[model samples]
Target: MIQALVIDDQEINCILVKGLLENFFPDRIRPYATSNLAEALELITTLQPELLFLDISMPEMDGFELLQHVRKQQKAEVIFVTAHDAFALDAFDHQAIGYITKPIVSEKFVRTVSRAIELIHQKTNTGLVETLKKAIITSGNNQDKRITLTSQKGLTFVDPAHILYCESSGNYTTFFLVNREQIVVSKQIGSFVSKLESHSIIRVHDRYLVNLQHVTSYIRGNGGLLVLINGKEVPVSVRRKNDLLHFFDE
Candidate 1:
């Protein structure tokens, strides 16, 4: 069972989160909630929970302020719950697992919590490792040469030339190679864009980060489709279509 905690200023909000956890997770998660920040701080130290559902609009110190205190005790997968969308970027900056807006929609809550659980599994189990795990990169003469991919099993050094494309699922990115080998890493596709951009890797879609070196053909459409060297077809989003075309033109 996973130990989880919910901290909210409103008693009703705390109850709602606790209820939702019980309904969705049932036997998987053992949840505790508190409306008092002081009590919540004590609980963080005492429980040392693996999952935390924190509210951002609490009195005195908000969720972000509380996170500063919580981090000192232990590392927990934090999902920020708030009615304000304004803090979404800040929450992501703090590396929170998920940011949930107020008046919790069950479907959205389930989806967000499901992702948090997946990340937790990745951290605790041998799944995808930690999402913040660094990808050591080597670049020479202003060119990216290699990327070190780390996994629970071991580390694998990959050459940019050999990479075909990368696909993103939630927080994980899977690198597909020319040899049909796949390396899964616990990092977002956006994290790798700057590192691999010099080596002809680019984001063609929200879910796809591709190495343009391996693109064999481009089939035109609204955003169009890309035919890779290995005969894999990848979608090109309309937003990034012009950028891709410009790359091709160059």
Candidate 2:
């Protein structure tokens, strides 16, 4: 069975999360719910659950505080559930397995939990450092200046300037770089789009994130295709064609 813990000051939220876990995993999951951070910390140390569902807003000890404490004690999978969208970026910065918004939909909740489970299994089998590096590299923006990538070998810090573009393959994202190296990370194109918005990278298609710096020319074909420095052609979405042209013009 997969042991889980729910930490929320509000009883309703705790119950809601517990119910979802029970429904999703049935007999394979056991959950411990608590309102107090102190009690939660104790349970976390002793129980060492495979997953933790946490709330960002709480009296005395906030979600970030609890996360820091957990990091100090042990490395357990964490998914933060919060009402405030403002905390989403911060939650990602802390390497949270997932950041779920309030009034969680059953589908999204189950998906997030499943993702956490997969990540936990991967970390347990491979190692934590490798997983963390891959997450940082895939989630970083070119303007971020730095990123991290992980593998069975070890973690590698990457300079975003070296990245050429990112492509999505099924459930994975592959990063193409200037030096002819590629880094495959476990993330969707949409997630990378949001994180790399401030950088030179733009979503040219549903499956491609192109770096404006590497774009040499755009061929106006049936829809459109962007030609990169390495002679690779990437499709441009019809909806974003005009916007891409305007961005280049500016």
Candidate 3:
């Protein structure tokens, strides 16, 4: 049986998380629930569970403080369950498996739990984990300058300038970088449209978002295609051709 622990200051929240996990997650989650930080710390020491559900804010001791203490003594992947959306980016900084926003919607809860399970099964690579920890800590100073992507493994730091293009395939979105590296995310393409648009990345087609800075040439005819600096040809819908040209003229 896989061990799981839920730490929340509110008794009801702790119980609710525990119940949700038991129902949505497979029977593998053998849950241990606690509201007291002292008791929770003791349980972490004793149980050393493989997974943890943490709340960021608590009386006397907060979630980040608890995480710091527990991480030093044990290695458990955490999925933060908090009422505040502000901590979501902070959660990625700590290489958390996932973040659940306030009021606890069941569908969102299940989605986060599903991602956590993927992390458990994938066995996060050490190099990538280290990269993420460093990226997260350093990211606070560069929030306005850089964008970070959080996934099952960890966080990836991306410079909008180095991005070549983004491609969508169903639920997955792939980021192609200037260094020839690709960061494949499990989120939908539209999810990233807003975050990247301001950086000069524009949607060329439903399946493609190309960085305007990386467009080397445009191959015309048959709806045409964009040749990126990296040599990848991203399609352009004929209807969007005028918009693409208008963007260039701006």
Candidate 4:
């Protein structure tokens, strides 16, 4: 069963959302709702829900702020709820998967939730495939030999130690190597995190993931910059600076 959460300052809004979920998706979803911001955050941590219905305007903090906190913990698909249309663009700016305005229409709500459920199913299936692939590849002592990557050309087995960094451009990720070689793959940078992160590859910014093994030096600033072995510099986000430092501290 998929876990779902609803967050709103107004008790009625929470109740209404929960009711809608119960009515439309009684068997598929295990629904929870909260009007308190503190309780909502706690629930998000504990439940690690796959879907979140969040009210954009709230007393303590808006949905966007809460969503940022959620992202740090889990990859919950968000559906922003608001009374005004102005917040719609802002919701998309935050990369919310769906947005709905009040008073909620049953048909629209069903449509949006249907899409979210489909996406969740797709991710679950993909995860299963990846798990099987990893099991087959890591069956022997050759586990650390190479990581498989798919590009426009074909599948490439790469040595993780040779990777300098990975850069993201929209949906594409370009892998840069220590030998000045580059491989472009048609997938989000986040998709490769699990596969490459074990090899000292860490995301330094939204657009850049760096291999600490190849980092020559770090230049400090607000966020900072990393000089790689191949004389290439990668900018680190301020939010991720402490993480990079802590990695070295350990």
Candidate 5:
């Protein structure tokens, strides 16, 4: 079963969305609706739902503000349901799993929810199993592992300690290890980043991603740059330098 929460100020919108999800997903969907952000936060802290459908415009605390709070505590995938199209880009910038515009279309809503459920399974089941397997292979012992990666070739088990950095290459991503080897993955860096974002990986540039554990120094070049433990330098766009620096400071 997939646990879900719906946060909207309007009762009708909440009921409509809940009914739609129930019709499609049946007993698999656990829907909780609330008009208050504080109550939603409380539910999140306790229930730790796998999915959250949020409305951006609200009375006291809006969806964006609620999202910030949710990201701090839980790994729930967020799907923003908003009336305005202008906030779509901003929602994605915050790493929202999906964005749905209202008045909600039944087909689109179902499709978005399905995607969210798939992502939940991928992250919790497949991703975690790979993480554990990596620990056993690397340590030659049975212990919990922290990170894992999959590619076109095969699963490349890794210790977070051995990772120097990661870089995005269009639709593909490359991971540089401390042992002077690289892991090329078919998935986009954004996908990898989403999985590892809660860990040490940080986005230094639009195309360049780095694991903070392997970041040796920050250099101010023509544009800013991140010097990794492997002695490789990755250019950071001027626009993202401040955000990177702020992330490090935290």
Candidate 6:
């Protein structure tokens, strides 16, 4: 049986999806539903379901925030369920395999769920399994401090060590990693600097947040640039040059 968990602020939405699972996949899926985020989180921790149907907009905790916690603890494949498609881009950025728009279409839900099942069987989800594993430790007094980044499909949990650099434009930030690949999220560079300050990540320019661990060589001059181990050149702002030097020297 496929363990499935459905979370939505609306009780009706939860009921509707659960009903669909029962009627269509009665033998295949064993589903559980909750309209409360707190209760949902607890169930997720205890049940450790293989599939998640999460709503984006909620009262106190949105799906994105809850996902940080979910991705931290479990290896469930997520499918975002929402009333509108406004956050579709953000959903995809987070690595969600499917996006089910509300007033739920039977065909789309079934198709997406089928795809989720197909992907769940693939080689333990490859890089994502290890990525999430290192990024989120759900043990006693969790030790590793990892950053949860928004991806093209869902929220991506990243170990600070895996990051190469971040380039931002307008309201979006694109993360370039050393191992997996590049993921573009909707947040700007300013939002990430605070989260990464303790780590080796530093904002060298308005457009860049480069991981100091990945800096292979620093080419100096007026507004000098850095060469990352991944072969990418990131520019260092004139104003932040002194700060970078202090950080390195320290």
Candidate 5, residues 1-250, lDDT tens digits: the string is 8889999998888888888888899966788877776787798998888899999999888888888888888778899998999999899998898999998888898888887876776566576566667667888764445455665455566777677777777877888888888888756877766766666777777777777887789887756788877678889888877778788788
| Lowest lDDT 10-residue stretch of candidate 6 | 121-130
Q: Per-residue lDDT tens digits of candidate 1, residues 13-55?
A: 9999999999999977899999997899899988999999989
The Cα RMSD of model 4 versus the native structure comes to 13.1
Compared with the true structure, all predictions reach lDDT values of 0.86, 0.83, 0.84, 0.89, 0.80, 0.85
Q: lDDT by residue for model 4 over 1-250, one digit each (tens)?
A: 7899999999999999999999999987889999999999999989999999999888799899999999999999999988978888889998888999999999999999988987787677557647756886778657546876666465666889999999999988999987787999768999988888889998999999999998989999999999987788899999999999999889
Task: Give per-residue lDDT, candidate 1, residue 171.
Answer: 80
Scanning candidate 3 in windows of ten residues, the lowest lDDT window is 121-130
Which sections of candidate 1 miss by over 4 Å? 127-250
Model 5, which residues run further than 4 Å from truth?
131-250
Q: What is the model-wide C-alpha lDDT for candidate 6? A: 0.85
User: At residue 5, what lDDT does model 5 achieve?
Assistant: 91
- Residue 79: error of model 5 in Å? 0.7
Candidate order by decreasing lDDT: 4, 1, 6, 3, 2, 5
**Candidate 3 C-alpha error for residue 86, in Å:** 1.5
Global fold similarity of model 1 (TM-score):
0.53
Mark the regions of model 2 whose C-alpha exceeds 4 Å error after superposition. 127-250
lDDT of 3 by residue, 1-250 (tens): 5689999999999999999888887565788899998899899989998899999999978888888888898789999999998998888899888888768899988887777776665454545555665776777776446677656556677889988998899988988889988888877888888989999998889999999898888888766889988788889998888899888788
- Residue-level lDDT tens digits of model 2 in 105-193: 88898888887776765566456655655665688845235665553335456666677899998878888999998888776778777
- What does the lDDT come to for candidate 3? 0.84
| TM-scores of all predicted structures | 0.53, 0.52, 0.50, 0.56, 0.54, 0.50
For residue 199, give model 3's deviation from the true position in Å. 42
> Model 3 Cα displacement at 227 (Å)?
30
